[model samples]
Target: MFASVFVVILGLLYCRKGSSQSFLGRPRLYGPSEALAKEVVYFKCEVPDYAGDEEIYLQLFKVGDRNRSLGGYTSLRGEVGAIPKVIKPSHEGYLECVVSAQNNSGITPTVSHPHYLKVIDPVKGAEIIHSDPMEFYEGNALQLQCQLSAGTHVSYKWLLNGQPVSQSPVHYAADNLLRIDRTSSKDSGSYMCMATNTFNKTTVFSSNSSEVVVTIKDFVSSPNIAFTVLKEDSQNYSAVVTCESTRGTPPITFSLYNRTELVTNMTTDDRQATFKVPLVLDRHLGWLQCQANNGERIAYSDWLPLEVVPAGGPVTMHYDFDLGENYAIVGLRFYCKVKKGSHLRYQWFLNKTLLQDRGSFYYVANEAPKQSILLLSVGRSSTGTYHCEVSDSFDNTTAISSKKHYLDKDVLNRLPILLVAVVFGCFTALILLVSICCCIGVMFRRRQYGEKSLLNLEMDTMRAAYEGDLDLSVYNEDPDVVNAARGDEFDHASEASVDE
Candidate 1:
């Protein structure tokens, strides 16, 4: 029984080896069945229970061209199953692979199902296809298309003025076509189309179409004017007036009007025109309007009223001081008067030198129309001529005081000397007049006393001769002696009076 069991075990082992060999006769390829051009493909034919050590071969060929082998491998064995085959297909078509196995007994081969490969080339060119009408009008429907000559799976994108044409309520983009429900002047620009291969989005292979200029024609509308005031004063005003149309074509001319007459005419190749109105007067203050013309249509702006008033006169300046005073002393006040001006500016000058407001010696006392006074704490250096200048802020018209007043060394210094000189002169004249009156009185008195004195002297001499000793008696006795004595007395009296 033991011998019988051994023989049975050997028979079962042979049956198992035969079953494995039968399955190896047909090998199945295991790899990617579909590939692209220039794509590396790896494949291996697998056989169940076959050792890796074997003589095997692999062959690759296109379908329906079995005679022309694209590639192949040699010296493959069943122990090695089927050698892995690597291939890179150059063209797009169906491809097939065959694996052959060889051993000491024989050789067997098996073919795999065909593999489909796809190759792609980028888009080479693109163009914007024109519609029926080359020109568009405002509020009109329009459509544009992009035409491309490219490989499979190509896509299109539209651009306007180098920006993407996005879908909106009025614009629609479907596939390679763009539609506009309503067009306007804003839609007038260069339109372009771009074609790209979607198969390789990362490769960035795209073609741009030639720019197509779309002209949009429309009537001028929404006429309006804008004003920028450059300068404003009481007399005149300067401004920049601009006329514009919200929607219009180029070559538009603008005309500015004051009341009914045209003031200026301007031509522009744009939608708007600007004019600089310089030194506009009160007469130019009426209703102003502007119009725009584009050789086909004319649009007018609403009337804008402009008003200007007259400016004030130049500044007039004057100096006020005490006329009776000879010199300005310490604690003296003077005034600068500014008149006939608006927005006046004041400056004080001392002997042609600018005087600062802040100083210890001088300061502004009362700044009023009547005053504008300058007070001084007199110093030796304060003795100089002073004047003031006034200017109008608006017109820059300046005026300086005609009278320049001055301070001098103290008034007291020369006043006493002058008073003394005047008093001395008057006293001298009074003395001379009194002396003339005295001389006249003396002459008259001398004449009157001369006669009276003669009589009085004779009486006195006779009295003396009687009262005295012999001399009196002798004078009373003799008339001649008495007359002589009287004469002598008269002479003495007259001489004495003359001397007095």
Candidate 2:
């Protein structure tokens, strides 16, 4: 009986001890390290929804590809803590961290989902600022500057028209400064800078490909070959050319010069430099050169040819359109616009004939003369070659623009009324001339011998068809004295008759 009790007690004690446990779960694989280099930020992981008693323990780790453990931690709590640890990567590349969980309930482990870290490279930016003198000339100097920022160990490159710049070894040392000892149009192009650097075995770069234009110190500008005139009447005005040298530094002014005499001037903006004038002067007939300087380096443009031509001819304010005159529509006005108070000797012409610009209404001077607009009512008679001539009077020179507009005769033919009146006027003038000569001969004859002839009266009236009635009666009058008085008396009646 004693042996049996001892055996039962031992069995109870053996059962009392805990020994039903499972091996640790398979290891979880963390994600491969990856970064966008521009947008990605941080990542991490740990045991999921953990809730346990008996002092749960956990570890953080990094496992090598060779299956050897590289990193981990101890004393980790198992109560919904240490999850998504928020890991940050220094550079762009693949990297990872591992978190492990443990508990006494089974002496096993649990793993949360794996995560990835990413980094991004941002785009670079640059700005160029500059200015030029109001009137730049040759032998001038200009200095230009550009600024930018990018990634570490970054190298820079400067380009003109997509080609790398070899000039100015100092500026080319590392794509930043663009020095123009003496600039010209050839230096003008789409300019840009590029930066390249390595970030965690990945390349990050930034660039700006906007254009920069270089201009020269020049005089009057010429009308472009691609120029077209609007329907402006005979008016003097100005033409403007944007002389841009976007690579210079500020407070620069631009000026206009006619030969050796200076005409107008202006300041510059960050992007564009401009030269404006009243264009009313023919000064632009010559090469217009734009010059710029940055107080150090000077630049100039090839002469640009420009002309200050009138828009059209002058006509009555309300000329007779006569209903069907469509061809006369191209030109609407004539103007004698004064671009500058100094160049105000505004003069215009039609077919070499001086336009009668009386003091009251023929011309207009404006404050903003460079871009001034002129208007003069136009008519068919005024629709011919017209000229806009301007002189500073000081240059001992003149600028002129002559242009012609030929209305389609076919269009004018539609208005046969005006043509008919012109032709009839000419015919009447011819007849009057013939009548005058004949009457003179007759008067000489009548003074010698008093006489009357029926044929003479008929001839007088026939010729009078063109001459006035007074002259008609004189030639036929009682062949004598009353002739002179009759010439005066019939004058009014004949004038009325001829008008019809």
Candidate 3:
């Protein structure tokens, strides 16, 4: 009985010893590496459960500041424990987790490896900025910067046309800045920036900057000038001149010149501009030329030769129609012409009212002085009888009017053919009249030659019969000598007749 009691005591001692054992391995601390200031941070501590029935307590604190605990979690079941703490800028530093178990053997502590908590300030109100001239020419350098109101550990990237821009030979992207070494037309687009911290990659922070438009302009190219003569006279010439550049940016300044004299200049947002130029003979207008300037460069067009042709003669008017599908008349064209005139001024009268610039409904194109056109929309006041008055630009009083004619496409089509036939008949009659005049002239010359030959023969016979010391060849060569010989013979014949 004493031996059995001693064995029971040994078993009880072993059970007490086993109940006081400590945790086996160190605790593992898990948390975010970086966190925004004034944000809630969670730390998890996982400890090995050596004695399952023991109470476990975990503490999270900075490594160097072991005196004060940041947060704590307790578990009676000895499971994974988590603690949350409000992290501030002051809380940025190294942190660690310590877990302890309390049992019959008192408390045992196991510390985890140090963890780094980098508290950061989020970026806000990001924007893109640029300075100096807003417009850049080709081959010019461009620079832009990303700016933020408040941030920490900030990084920047550039975006163009909503796509991420990578570094290239001509394009450069660095922290907070983007640059183009040499700008071109293709480089023109919208530019933006994104400013963020490393935490934004996995966090809810965003710092996209507002977009800024970047413009790259093209240099002005050599210009060319073209002109259509509207009217001309002995004193003045009028034309519509166009100045153009094949390739260039807008807001171009175009200047028209008559030799060295500047006639006019215009500033337009397009690459081409038109000017109405009127030249005078007294001023001695020379060749017309044009110049284009885009603030970066200047170009000039080749000289254009311009001359004046005076207007003259019988004025006539004809009509034609621009037909659409199904032979529908969409537009009407009235042509006023002068048979022998150039640089003529033309005016059209509908009933009696003058049609001067009646909005877009009417267009007047005097391509040449001899031929002026009045184009009209079919339904826009194109009805009624039409007559055209024309004259030289120098003299309006000499203007002549053509007979009024009602416009009917079907009737006018046959009118042109009839007019052509009439013109042909007049030309043929002129040729016939010239031939008849030539025949009459030949007959008169032959009759005069026969009379002179008969007179010369009569003089030769009289000289031979009389045998006088005078040269009868003088009578044939000189008409006055032959006339005197004829008078003497006629007087002798009168005497002989009187005696008979």
Provide TM-scores for the models: 0.34, 0.24, 0.45
Clash count in backbone of candidate 2: 64
lDDT (10s digit) by residue, model 3, range 8-90: 99999877665554444688999998888878978899876455676777899899788999999987877788899988777
Q: State each model's CA lDDT, in order.
A: 0.67, 0.47, 0.79
The model with the greatest TM-score is 3
Evaluate model 2: give its TM-score. Answer: 0.24
- In candidate 2, what are the lDDT values of residues 1-500, reduced to their tens digit? 99999999998765643221222333333433544434423232333443333344444343224253333444344332222333233443333443333434434455544334444344456555456542344335544455554343446666777888776533333345556565543454566666555555755566563555544543222211122222233453445566655455454555555555555556654435555544444344665665554455545555655664332233211112223354444333343443333332445565676665342223433322232223433444545555555544323244534344343324534557878899999999999999999999999998756545766787888887867644555466464667877788899889999999
Q: Positional deviation of 104 in candidate 3, in angstroms?
A: 20
TM-score of model 1 vs. true structure: 0.34
Candidate 3 CA-lDDT value? 0.79
- TM-score attained by model 3: 0.45
Per-residue error (Å), model 3, residue 212: 9.2
